[model samples]
Target: MGPYSGSKSYSGGEIMGLKVFFSVLAVSVAISGCAKSPPPAPNHLIMLTETADGQADASFMEVDTLEECESRASAAKKVFPMAKIKYIRHYCTHTNIKFEPFLHNPEPEGPSYVFGLNFVKDGKVLSKVSNFKSMTDCENKGKQVCVISYQNIVPGE
Candidate 1:
């Protein structure tokens, strides 16, 4: 039984009980009042390329920046060590900034931009691409570093 059992009168014990109940209620309301934030968006860009070796088209384009593209291209060169870049082209930017689609390969911890935008500092708009193919006589320009050959690979294999 409570200390104020059967008592119609307001006692110090009853006041203490009320204080405890109200404090708990206040704490609960405070804890549950917040709203969670929404997730960020993704950035994807697509392109098509044709070269002397072959032609490649994709609805889902590659994800990378100009520098990253260059780096990967260089790695691709290691396959053909003597390869060098004769001349490179920027192709296209796809012209849509807000366009993005779900990644077909895998998901990441958070949203990452597929294309990075940059401004020209030395009178040249730096070239970047998700699709690229080195043209014929590519070596005439300098060396053949990167060239995509699609004639040999199977689809979605």
Candidate 2:
């Protein structure tokens, strides 16, 4: 039975072409199946406040959208008419000290973590917020004055 044998015959080039076609098809399917999903959007808003002396206060509110975050800020302003409120995002430091909400030390030898609505201010961050650590810390700084507040960008609900 010649090269046909009982069925058909394929040349060396034709066999290689078939193998390459199937290999490519399989790879495409595998890659498509492994496509990564996008990251989730922000869904919670954090409200942070700091007095002139440097003590800070923080609160978190779940929000569906940016508009909802703003709405909550408006409501908060009504309750705290004297506060200077702004909107920002919250990112934790490697040490995650900001969440501690307590003084690392009266005079921090290492970096101080700042837990407030606005972690960044005027070109400064946690270390420069002041020596104060909490609301009580601010009171200790001196006579109370203006309270600076921030509404953090919406995060996970």
> Which number leads on lDDT?
2
lDDT of 2 by residue, 1-157 (tens): 5876788688999999999999999999999999975333334444555434544444444556656666776676665645453323332211112222332132324343332222333212222223335545565565332122332222331
Candidate 1 has its poorest 10 consecutive residues by lDDT at: 39-48
Model 1 / residue 98 / CA error / Å: 5.0
The 10 consecutive residues of candidate 2 with the worst lDDT sum are 91-100
Model 1, span 19-127: residue lDDT tens: 9999999988887785443322212232223333343322223344545544544554454324322223333222223333433332223432222223132212323
Task: Assess each prediction's global lDDT (C-alpha) against the native.
Answer: 0.36, 0.44
The candidate that achieves the highest TM-score relative to the unseen native structure: 2
TM-score of 1: 0.23
Evaluate model 2: give its lDDT: 0.44
